[model samples]
Target: MIPKINGLGRSFAGVAAYCLHDAPTPDERSPETSERVAWTDTRNLATIRAERAARLMAATAKAAPDLKRLAGGSRGGRKLAKPVLHYSLSWARDETPDRREMSRAVDGSLEALGLDGHEALVVAHEDTRHPHVHVVANRVDPETGKAATLGNSKLRLSRWAEGYEREQGRIRCEERVKNNERRRAGQELVRTPWERPRHWARVRRERMVPGRARRARGPRDEERVDMEAWRRVEAEAWETVADGRWRSLRHLETRAREEWVELHRRQEEMRQRLDRESRTVLGRLRIWRTERSLRELAGAIRGRQDLVEGWREDLDGYHRDERAELGKAHGERAREIERGWHKFYRSRLVEAERRAWAVRETMKERQETRERERGPSIIIPIPRPRQPRGPERGGGGFER
Candidate 1:
């Protein structure tokens, strides 16, 4: 089994829509092979989304309030961030695990990630030859209102998968086995160059082109500029600024300016080195030579160019990974700051509500006291004296 854990996402509804409905194309959707493995609740997509949203809201509402004052106003509650964890498990092309096995694998993987009991929607897709199941789980625990710790989650899942493969008596993946061994020995997991998706794509494309076509294409100069290196430096700078040791955000900004200056200095140094190397290599190539010497020099230049390109690509990949890690760290730090602001706002809101309630109670008590102090006053009805009736119409002159 090959387990691919995707990135942490924000929108539960969006993910649910994609996994349950949007995953299969129209032709594949007619068969309706999507199965809800572990969702005990209603199967309606809208209902599931609403329930999950409500659960997330409840969890966030119950989070403990932090009273620390921050410069920015609290807006974190306006949107949910990184609550969705989507991943998939695929079997070998020849091996088709039954639904029961797939369910077990899903549960096992979730358990490995410390999210077994969390709300998860598992959907099996039969659109491809290889049977695979996609799992979308909420990272936030509904009960405790705490996000599950995801430290070394990839390694943990890989270990679980390895054991699972052994139990199934399947051919073990050598790469995964080596990675597990490395993990056990406290060594960093190393990925081969081709393991990079983009690098692999480039390799595959190159392989597809005919040799004649490739030769005709000639050698095109790749931009020697390393953008990934600059991105890595910038990401590292932000991460450094976001570190907890800083007295305040303002102080962090000041430190960031210093890092920025240092980055520019390094950039200048790199530019000068590139210039010197380019001039030296070009100057040597410009010298006239015999046809044999020319051919030999051409071959040498090509070999050196290939070596340099390979080195550059490898370095770029390393820098890309570094930037990604730094970016993730910076995001976590930013989320922490946002959460602090959120808690602070929640605490302030609660205090305001309490004060308002106390004021209302005080007003009610004063009204009651005033009513009690003023006793009721009695009023007797007073009748006015009746006027003498006017003389009858017929006997006006006579006294009746």
Candidate 2:
């Protein structure tokens, strides 16, 4: 179960109206889901709304008028008096607790959080996939005439969820995901046989192609075939050429045609090589680099581990020799270097991975463009050669 606490609200009237909204149907007064006012015996929505509104008004009249002013002067905006708190206590669909149990949980949570004295509404909502309750509480205590502070409400809610899970003996969706993450993190980080070490193994071929040309009204921006950059340049070129004022199409067309031909030639060559069971130059280079990087990372990790183990042995010996502080300092230094090296390697790998992704994207776009160029088949019907009416056989007469 997870509790979603939506910080705070200023208007008590708005909070009351939200809580009093008809369940199942907003217009109907049918109370299909259970609802009740906490800290009071009121179960009716209208009565709860009226009672809460009146309590808010009375509290405001008696309480500190400078509360809003003190919490940052009003300035240009409307004075904020966020004394209403909204909370949604949700349970997983699989673990549907009964009305009594739900109420007990809510009561316990509110009391535990020190908001039991505040005026509040607890309405069970059956509309969502998961069973949950909407809590609208007046942060301004009617009896004390002071707003209730929700310090570390998130921490408190997490504690409540854990306790609830223990009591109910059911694991929540969040808990399951957390467990999976922990298990995954603890396991060895080895790539599968089919998985490539470098992220850009998929897109290495396309990034090699040069970008399209545009008319030069001024110095050209260094053209990039990067997806978004290519698109922007394409659009700008189109707009510039389409405008009647600039009448220079020859250079643009010639440059674009040459580039297109080169790109097509490269793609064709790649296809021919694949047919003959040969890898392209770029493909071979990428594979080699991927293998080298993986090997280096593995060696680095192993070396670090071995270094730490050796340091542990030395530390034990030093402690035996009564030079414990010196051993501790050396051990700390070794661990620091290990952490720093790992951090550096992690950053380098991350940068390489991002570049690989860019290459992959470029290749994907090129593949799509190629597919579009190879449009649907054209079927032309050929007229069959006239069979010699070998003598008007139908009429039983020979044709001249």
Candidate 3:
């Protein structure tokens, strides 16, 4: 359990009203648990608002008249003593503390802080995922006429939590708490505990607004950048420039033209093979009259050899013709591919430069702004007065 302590409520009446009053919208199924409330008999916001504040003031006066004296003037040790002490005791979501155990723990914790004699109200709120109780106590002791210093109160509460856990068989010890704290501080040897789901949601919310909320890790003004990822992108861009891949618009265009020529060479090779096969098929059709005749023994002997010879000759001629035809066709295709690749490569390279330039400019502006905020440097010019020239006098100063 973690205890959050605060000095709240400028006046006794203000504190009393806050403690007794129910939330504006009450939960019928899971109502708040209230205890030790003197002024307001019932947990109703309307009833508390109508007549509780004045009654609470009277109650406080009867309990601690010295506190009233302290409030009327600045005679108390504090320049302005806080009239009420407000705090909350919250447990992990898995721990379901019963009413009796919670009350005992709350009483023990309050006594440990030296507020046992004062009037207090403990209200358990069931709305949150984690079960917690809020304790509001009058800081002033009627007999002593002074408020107790709540220094190192968290340590006291921690001891109380450990005792409560042992007596109730909760098994959470001081050692475990210390280990958890060490793990949260980034100790490698200690294993981090799995946090409740609500913790992650709270973290995400804090990052979105940033600096608006307090976190256990301390203050963060903004989201931290992944410097490694940033450096990777920067290095890649510079490497491309250094390798002469995208040094200039003309250089990128030249690389694109090279790729286009290679693509055309592959297409021409495929076209030559396809044209030769078509010519061989046409030549075979003229020599072979019918499938039945080719299958006949004498017909096959007379025509098969002639058919094979004719097709071979025709395929060789087609290969030569296709080589000439493809040379012309590839020239046009290469130009088209070159134009498309040039436009694409140029746009991409320009985008990369713009992104890198933007990052550099942002960093420069931040540095300059920091220098401006630090104010100008002071350069002190020490005066070195020249020595006065005088007529030499052995025993008396010269008059000029």
Candidate 4:
């Protein structure tokens, strides 16, 4: 909430110079700001009386676009010349009324200070960090040249502003204005908190124009809600809220929220990507393991096959050798049997011839008188190997 105060003075140029020079630099203006302004109608007054030159210089600066449309003499603290006497006030962002009630409160301040009428203008300024207004007045009154004193305008303005805050009943017009406009946008986003939508809309409404009719629409019966009366109540309530909730922001919450959202999105994306990579790696590993197992199995089968074939070849060679040995044995056995029979027959015949010779010799020898009686008795036995008795026989073993 910006603090604001009003004043009445005679010189536009003098006041402009004072606000610029005598007052603290715009950098230094604060709730402590105490400066003079004028309220006058140049149309009915002389140049010196209205001080149009000074008023014009002070109101030249424009208000920021984001702020509500400026009413009164200056945007933030500018000086412009019009036919009517203008009321100007210096308002701090920390002390100004909520947008919903600013204009009415400013106007109400004028009346409360007994500075109303007299062909008036109200310039509200916002160019500086702490915005303020300048009220340029004609020394010559619209009714008479009798100069109007500022007459406790500051105290009255402050009191009225304070009262508006404490006397609140319904929501402030500005709050309602802001909440209505913001409600839909926040709802659409879904990311915004539910409570914020209505509050933002209320701020939007407060920024809307306040016309000659005050409220944009009228009652059904054509009776108008007295916005001026409403302003009084709001002013009192403003004093309480202004110092408490509307204090300078500790930090910018909006930026923090955006940063959180972006960070969360990045984290989720990384998690998903990691999960996919893990699955792919796992699948590849499974395939590799399976292939390795199959290759090992195939190698084992090939080794077994080779071993079996080698063993079969060895068995066939062994059987062939055994059959050859058997055949040689049979041939040798048949030869041996035949030779034995021949030898037996030859021996028997020799023995029979010996007997016949001996008989003949005996006849002859008898005549020779036993001359052979001294002949040595000679008998020789033939040497022969024993034959195999059974069907099983041993041949010249290894040679066969």
Q: Could you say which candidate leads in TM-score?
A: 1
Best candidate, lDDT? 1
* Model 4 segments more than 4 A misplaced: 1-10, 16-101, 119-121, 138-140, 167-400
lDDT of 3: 0.53
Tens digit of lDDT per residue, candidate 2, span 1-400? 8888876766666555555554336576454333532322222223554446535543552354354455543323333367667787888777667788888878877876778876666767665678887776666554444566676676577676767777877656565345444433443223454432222311232121112222222112323224444444445444543342122222333343354445445545644543332124444334335446554344334444453344345444543454334334434543443354335434443444445456657888999999889997689999998765645557545655
Clashes of each: 0, 1, 0, 73
RMSD in order of candidates = 27.1, 27.2, 36.1, 60.1
Pairs that collide, model 1: none
Scored by CA lDDT, what does every candidate get? 0.56, 0.52, 0.53, 0.41
**lDDT per residue, candidate 3, 60-161, as tens digits?**
535454554665643435443466677888888888888776777778888888887765666667767787777776665554555666755665776667
Cα deviation in Å at residue 309, candidate 3? Answer: 99
- Select the stronger candidate by TM-score from 2 and 3: 2
Give candidate 1's error at residue 268 in angstroms. Answer: 43
Give lDDT tens digits, candidate 4, residues 25-126: 557643343333322222222343333544542332121211223222222323322322344544444554544355555556556755454333334344
Sorted by TM-score, highest first, which candidate order results?
Answer: 1, 2, 3, 4
Between candidates 2 and 4, name the one with more favorable TM-score: 2
- Which lDDT value does model 4 have at 389? 47
Model 3: CA > 4 A from native: 11-79, 92-96, 173-176, 179-400
lDDT tens digits, residue span 1-400, model 1: 9899877776666665666643456567433333533332212123455336434533443341221112233324323357678899999899968878888898899889998767677777776788888887776555544567686777788889999999998745988898778655545456765442222222242221112211111112213223343334434433443342223433433443354445445545654554454345453243213223554475435446553444346545665575456445544553455455445444443444444455556667898899888867679989997755547445565584
